[model samples]
Target: MKRPSLRTGVRWKISIAIAAVGALVAVALSLVVHNSARVSMLDNSREVQLERLLFAQRMYDSTKEPKLGTKLNDPALPHDLHVKMKQGRRATYVQETASGVPDVWAAVPLSNGTVLSLHSKFADSTTIMKDLDRSLIIGSVSVVFGGCALGVLIGGQLSRRLRKAAAAAGRVAQGNTEVRVGDAVGGVVRDETDELARAVDALTDALNERIEAERRVTADIAHELRTPVTGLLTAAELLPPGRPTELVRDRAQAMRTLVEDVLEVARLDSASERAELQEIALGEFVERRVGVLNPAIKIKVVHESWVNTDPRRLERILGNLLANAAKHGGTPVEVTVEGRVVRVRDHGPGFPEALLREGPSRFRTGATDRAGHGHGLGLTIAAGQARVLGARLTFRNATPEGIEGRDGSGGAIAVLWLPEHAPTTTGSFPILKLPG
Candidate 1:
């Protein structure tokens, strides 16, 4: 089924809700009042009939026969109100008599062994009921009509204002940052619109600022690239036939590294660097990482394992770990690898207590002593890359007996545990298979 459009105005919806509630209340109240009035009228009728019986009894007691009670009938009495007896027994009821007018009759048995009846017309009450019925019908019609009219008026006003805001939002979505939502009507009174308007205006201002900043960055990049490209081209044209022209070679190499780093950062920003997954032998990858750093450190290998991962990201992660260890800790950094797990320990003052809890936050480095060498983006980048690859990285202090202030001054240990592939007992491990 198709969903209802959100473009409908809030005023209309609010009005509809109010109308529905009012209608329900009117129905419920009318039912209660009508029933109550009917019950009261019936009770009053019964009471009047009882009163008439007492009056007739009084007259019968005074006189031997019901002769005085028969004279109780008057010209002004209701046609239906007349004394009557059935088989010498007295009875009372509200019913039409021989004259065909509604009346209340009260009957009594006299002490002299004669039946007597008294009746009174309830014409006023019947007329009052007819008037009340007419008034109720008119009142109900008026209530419904008034509620609908009010609802429609309110709904139209709300819808018109909301439409303006929606149009502003549409312009924003279309990249028109300058489009602003002006002061608009909102709330039951006039309470909420100001805040919403201010928020939208602020958002538009921020977006414009960001767009301007990006434009400046783009201009700067172009300016910076020109000189390097010209230098590279000029050096290539004039081949210096000297013994290992170090200056030209170095400049070219430096330029290449700078360009590559810039491109890589751009790729990272765009989220376009996709991992190429392959079944890699974990033992070899770990061993290769530790060996490449070539730190004069004792490295240990544990549990041979395999995992499916991208080699490029793995190499970069390991490079970051080794570099951080080399910079922060003293010589003899210990490297250990087991099934999808790698740990690097340095005999340097362990990560400061504050930074350890903060994890790899910006500018919070474990190696404050080497702060002059490089800004601290290594751990931050590593943590980010690990998250992208769905892996966990953690750090802790390694308190060996000689590692604190004694011999292994200023050392910290970082443990990286990657998930191990679930075992497949049916096939041989990758490394053990015969060469293809």
Candidate 2:
């Protein structure tokens, strides 16, 4: 199941990183500005307090009274500053108040063991700094919000481009070599995403070239061998009838079959290949086909199903699968049918890791030394036919690791699931008698 949103995780991760960086920078800048302003305000308050203390001393010397902000041994003065004054050292102290304001206290030792102290509150500076701090906070928030918005735009663009590239790669993987990441490779070599798009496009081109070359070679070889193989078959028939003649005829027939398979593969590689649909009693048809192919293969119809498919192509696929199993797998191969699905399993060394990982490749058989191997075109041809039929084909080891081909444990299993072409016969098809 897919999520509701088309947005990828990379987008959100990028946006989050941008938002976090913005928030961190804003907080740091706000703190630095706030602290600097408070320190400057305190310094100014201290200077004002000290000047007032000097005036108060002069005022007392002349009129024996203190100024409005100045006092004689003021108890309101900071205790620390008062102690300093009593020790005969002029001092000023800054004190913070709960009302978001601060007071500066200054004192001097007077003659005859008296003290003159002055203190002033930073009332105006407090209100001004409060407004400044509020402005900083709002600006910081705006910065963070703006950064987030920018990040969203950038992230969305990047995600969309990367997805486009990925989609192109997916099409290429599905054998659509014509797909290209043309416009998806946006910008002038700016980022890794753009580079990735270019790389995928290049890979598609290379794959297209390689497939074209392979198709040509396959077609040429198959056509070239067809005449000679057919001639050989004719020659074998003309020879005197004996065991040697039968062996020659069999070899020539195998050569002919190989040539035909190569031609089929080449045709399937082309885009013009198509399926010929026909309705059939799928289980009955499969049972008959299984019997004619090999009498030893055990086949069962679990639930009968009627489907529309190309019977000739289906037979080809089944024939190839059975032949592959009998040649490279252990004895007692089994075939099961349920609905529109058919599974072929054999007891053998199982599929190798390379075969499981990379599906079937031409001329690459995953068989042990005992069972022998073929040209490796069997599974590959079946896979191609499945594609034409719009079916899903899968290969896997039916048994657990290290237990394959041992004590009846299953080895490789190939499943062919055909899409129901909306068969007119909606009900289940009757089960057919299968061969022993």
Candidate 3:
């Protein structure tokens, strides 16, 4: 199994911590047991040796002989015990390796100027200690393994819960207000994870309610202004054909457009608009729409593709993009259709930093259009309509690739991607060549 990264999540950290603590405890216990066993065995061996040496010394003194019985007459005695016996010490023992074999030698002085020595090999105590050491090693390994296993189990559960909550919050951020963090697993007590989930769910509900209320207010305001706006437009049109009358007409038209755009936005917000999907030839659709608006605009097709979409809404999206380019960009607007993507590019001072950063907003104009006359709802409406059609719309500065006199300078490109299987017809349009 692959080990988890310690830096990435809590799972590995917890597991490692548990294993380390377990290893320390196991080592301490093993050391304590090993030391206690060694001390106890050595003390008992020394006491037995002393008792035998004293009995041998008393027998030698009574019989007036230099040697005692075979039990006390070992020829492999260490020289250190003989030297200690000559110094009048009654009982003495020393550890030694005689003939390469480890043993304890004990001696006692005999009354006939001789010494009695007893030998006890360390093999018995050594064998017992080795067995205990092996057992301790096995036990330590089991402890570490068990601790790590438990830590991984707990940490994995916690990480999964946190991930679910984070994913739900992400959906809410992306305008999915219906998402909620679900309940805990069976038999699992509620903890910080559950609390966080509840908080996110509550936040989503509050946002949904607030947004719905705002949409209702906006729709009501738009409906109420329609009557007055119509009256103003009628009054302006009835005036004489003069500069002042034209100004009044223009302002009235702008007001009407704003009110209509606001109403449309309100409807989209409330989910009142639904897509009516139909099969259509995408390349031909673009060509026809651009021709009606401005024949001078060039159309290029790489791979003609069909798409299933609401034609009215698609038209609105493309219309807004073309209109924005014409109003703000230089001449020669270009539309390219390749597969499921449609890109509208213009030779202009590209999109402003704010628009690219914060996306489109109603009534917010860019630095390029200092007059601020445009209501800034074109791109916003296009984006909203694209969403309704289940498509993605992105705006960016066009790079200098095929265009002449442009060296990676300013230009705006709006790309729209349609679903793959939304085709009604399939035919390729020849690529058009435009003068640089």
Candidate achieving the largest lDDT: 2
Please provide, for model 1 over 1-436, each residue's C-alpha lDDT reduced to its tens digit, 9 standing for 90 to 100: 9987677557767777877877777777777877788668766886777676776577667764444244333343433333434245555567655654467666655545454565567667667767777777777777776887788887776567667677776666444455677643344554345456667878888876785666456445745885786677578657776756666776666565445444444344333345566788877777776677674656777777778766777777777777777776666788888877878778766666545666665445644565654335566556545544445677777563234466554467776666554322211111111110
Q: Which candidate leads in TM-score?
A: 2
> Candidate 2: lDDT over CA atoms?
0.80
Which candidate, 2 or 3, has the higher TM-score? Answer: 2
- Rank all candidate structures by their TM-score, best first, as comma-separated numbers: 2, 3, 1
Give me the overall lDDT of model 3.
0.76
Off by over 4 Å in 3: 1-10, 57-121, 183-187, 366-373, 400-410, 421-436
Tens digits of lDDT, candidate 3, 1-436: 9987646677777888899999999999999999999878877887877787677666666775534332444556666666676697855454745543346667776655666676667677878888999999999999999999988998888887887778768766655565667543222767888877877788778888998998889889999999999999999989999999999999899889889999998877665566788888899998998889789999998998888888999999999999899888766688999988999988876677667777777778777453355778888888777777767777777644234445535578888888665422211111111211
Give me candidate 3's TM-score against the actual structure: 0.79
Clashing pairs in 1: 11-155, 12-155, 347-410, 347-411, 348-410, 348-411, 349-410, 349-411
lDDT of 2 by residue, 1-436 (tens): 9778765477787888898999999999999999898888788778877887787788888988877667776777777986797689998897888886777788889887888887777788878887998999899999888988888988988888887888777666766666677565566547888677778788777777898898999899999999999999998999998999999999899899889988987887775567778889889998999999998889999999888888998999999989888887777899999999999988876777667777777777764552244778888888887887777778888675566344786677888888866322211121111211
- C-alpha displacement of 149 in model 1, angstroms? 2.1
**TM-score per candidate, in order?**
0.43, 0.80, 0.79
